[model samples]
Target: MNDQNNPRDAESDYADRIKLTVALLGKNNKASDVMLARQLGRNVLLEELGAIEEPYRALQPYEIDSNQRDNFAVHTREDIVMVYSLAVRANEQLYEIRSLVRILIALLFFLTVLFFISVIWR
Candidate 1:
């Protein structure tokens, strides 16, 4: 039975969305921009990206061997590009970057406070 709002299984739903990426990449898959546009809706795929395939994705029917690296989402913005990695080390890079940004912000805040104090003292 399907819930009216939820509709399909999350992973199964992701399969369709993931196809758009595969189609855009021209990864020898059973889809194209035109086809996806019809099935998914217009402008679903960014045609100008031109199949660079830099930000990795795992296609459906994932056939993994022992050597296969389990991927993780690394700060994806909607549909443009996403990063993934191994050792279940999926989102680590993005997390690390975010942590660094937080630290940098804290340091800047401290410096700003010091500067304000000096200005007030003068």
Candidate 2:
């Protein structure tokens, strides 16, 4: 029942990860620097110190609100900062994915056309 590889099992393991990240941000600590601090075994500072009460309430036990989770992921100081940085990285990655997909599709279409042309010529 306990598979370490699959986090999507019966128990919500990612919740702990998310909660840890949220706690870091709730304390007004910067999330982007959390990794460095974690690597150095040090503490990181979070951003917005004020707007945490709402998130805390949302994160209360038995509350499985995805919106709250998203809010925590986005609005929290550490989350917002980290997400913004991630968004920039995601956008760059997205551009690359889109370009790659376009190239692959074009090549496939060209190959298909060539196949049809050869068949007709034959």
Candidate 3:
């Protein structure tokens, strides 16, 4: 029940998107991949909501150093592109993991069958 086109509405929406993105990103002990995925998700949601006038703001840019700014500049156009790329990369990685799990399951089944055969032959 937004008033539509209100400045506060825009800011609030932006804030909500940022919060949701942060939650989705969660923690990545290795890299900023999670953050990038969350930003991508936020962008997708914003596009769907028809409020893409501005991208969501970074949560804490002040804490990031100059060299590390690349990782925290989620508000820029190039940064948004990187977010999309990261999201796709994450999705592909998940898919690869699923495929590997399926293969392992099949392999385990085959091994169990072989074990039973050896037991019977003995």
Candidate 4:
């Protein structure tokens, strides 16, 4: 199980959330498949994050040589975005592992309750 007291874990999901927000904010891409993918991907990411606050806020653009904003600008730092992407993926794996553990715990609880009921009925 992950340590819930960890502040670092709390901040890690923000990267994925920012990515989702960016895709939703993207106005340049009009392709239906791409749009649908972005929506579904965002949905899945949200589900995986499990009730995050401000899950869809767009990242602010940063300073540069040109005054005009880029067409598909996501975040100020590309390097940080990449790092966040890696964090999101790593979090996904952790979620999967925790999910499996929860399933096993649920099954065990069910069996224990059944055993108690059978004993009481006897």
Tell me the lDDT of candidate 4. Answer: 0.55
TM-score of 4: 0.31
lDDT tens digits, residue span 68-120, model 1: 32221221232334222352365677788899999999999999999999999
Best candidate according to TM-score: 3
Q: Count clashes in each candidate, considering only residues at least 3 apart in sequence or on different chains.
A: 0, 6, 0, 0
lDDT of each: 0.46, 0.52, 0.60, 0.55
Instruction: Predict model 1's lDDT versus the native.
Output: 0.46
Per residue, candidate 3 scores C-alpha lDDT tens digits across 12-122 of 655565566557655554334656556556655454344454223222222435654553454466667987999999999999999999999999999999999999999
The C-alpha TM-scores of every prediction are: 0.31, 0.38, 0.40, 0.31
- Give Cα distance to truth, residue 66, candidate 2, Å: 31
Q: Which residue segments of model 2 deviate by more than 4 Å? A: 1-78
- In terms of lDDT, the poorest run of 10 residues in model 4 is 54-63
lDDT of 2 by residue, 1-122 (tens): 12334323212433344456665666455763564345222111111221122333322343436875676566557656887999899999999999999999999999999999999999
What overall lDDT, based on C-alpha atoms, would model 2 receive against the true structure? 0.52
